[model samples]
Target: MCLSFHSFRKLIASVLFLTFFFTGCKNSEKRTVKTEEITFIKEGELSIYKPGTDVPVLNLNIELAETDYETQTGLMYRTSMKENEAMLFIFDDVAMHSFYMKNTEFPLDILFIKEDMTIGSFQENAQPLDEGSLSSKVPVQYVLEVNAGIVAEKGLSIGDSISFQKL
Candidate 1:
């Protein structure tokens, strides 16, 4: 077929435009995936205590999940946590530690804890779905997760202490 230069250029441009448009749409759709829930552990009781004031009067409700599944799920789907609410993650021993908010829906404050019950370090304002690893500044035996702003509200400091019991 014989065509003019202008017509040929127009045809090529149309082809290119459609190619780019469909490809762009497909890629965008892939990016807009619906996030699903990941259950880490089974249901159990967890209790939190202020590190070591020698007074065990006040305690908090924690979902105890020592197994891989329970610990992995953690508190990813919960919409709200109470003012006195906390999650105590227990490990077999104190070791180098890190955490990420992959499927989590709420912002959190993470407290890396030592065997002595002293605060190893604190990651305040942990963003939801953030994959960045919040590493412990020191080796930690346990990790306490609370609502993002709760740490400052409670006047919790890096050197502040914490403790827990499996109920």
Candidate 2:
């Protein structure tokens, strides 16, 4: 086929443009992914006390994860947690809550608490990045995620009550 010089140049330009566009979309592995730094803020102090006693079972500087987004992102990217640091997840009603360690970088002990703030159940030593469903087994209104072994270290039991104050 015979074509004018301008027409031939236009065809070449169009072909080059489409070639680069398709190739760019296919190279997903070369894409630059931007990851933001996750910040840890001590928003409150929570104390887990022995039931019916004034003695403290454990005290933690906590980050409150009450909203849907906050609760979903609870400690997922944290590399380390202070022995006295924790994340508290608050729900709107009392119900069974299941948690997994997806994207979590450190192990944790998840304490499921009843409506009255007493611990209902515990998921111990949840491994980092494990997608296993750690259910409360009973209805709960609150969840406390602390460093693994904190419960055993403090001798904390299911019936221990927790109280918190915002800072």
Candidate 3:
């Protein structure tokens, strides 16, 4: 069948419109994947332990993961985290490393930890996107994650120390 120029232009426009509509919806869907509310305690206090340390009490909600899988997965796929809840990623040895918000819907404050439980560096209010890497300025063995901006709100800063304890 032979088509007139006007009809062909109309068909092209329709195809472009549908393509944009579907693409927008797909992007929105991906954004919500990690936006669901997570069931974590907010009103309770938890302790953090600095392995092989003799310092005083180090009260923190996040705890170190003792297993390899837990350390590797860290906090991936978490939709939401409570204000008082956190995740501490531990490594067997101090090394250069980085983290990203891949698959993480909410923004976070990432604290790179040294072997002595001191914060090497921290990145606050990190954006969620694939292939975004937040790295430590120095070699570190532990990392802590909390709700975005909590670090500054709590008056925590570089050179301020952190320690952990067994619960």
Predictions in order: lDDT = 0.75, 0.91, 0.73
Give all candidate RMSDs, comma-separated: 6.3, 4.6, 8.2
Q: Which 10 successive residues of model 1 have the least lDDT summed?
A: 39-48
Off by over 4 Å in 1: 1-59
> lDDT by residue for model 1 over 55-129, one digit each (tens)?
543356665647787678777776657756777788887888888998788899998888877777999999998
Q: How much lDDT does candidate 3 score?
A: 0.73
| Model 3 Cα RMSD, 1 decimal | 8.2
lDDT of 3 by residue, 2-121 (tens): 889999999999999999999999998888544564454333334443444454233557645548876665667777777767887778889987988877778889888889778789
Q: What is the clash tally of candidate 1?
A: 5
Model 3, TM vs. native: 0.64
Model 3 lowest lDDT segment of ten? 41-50
Scored by TM-score, the top model is 2
TM-score of every model versus the real structure:
0.65, 0.78, 0.64
Candidate 2: regions farther than 4 A off:
1-36
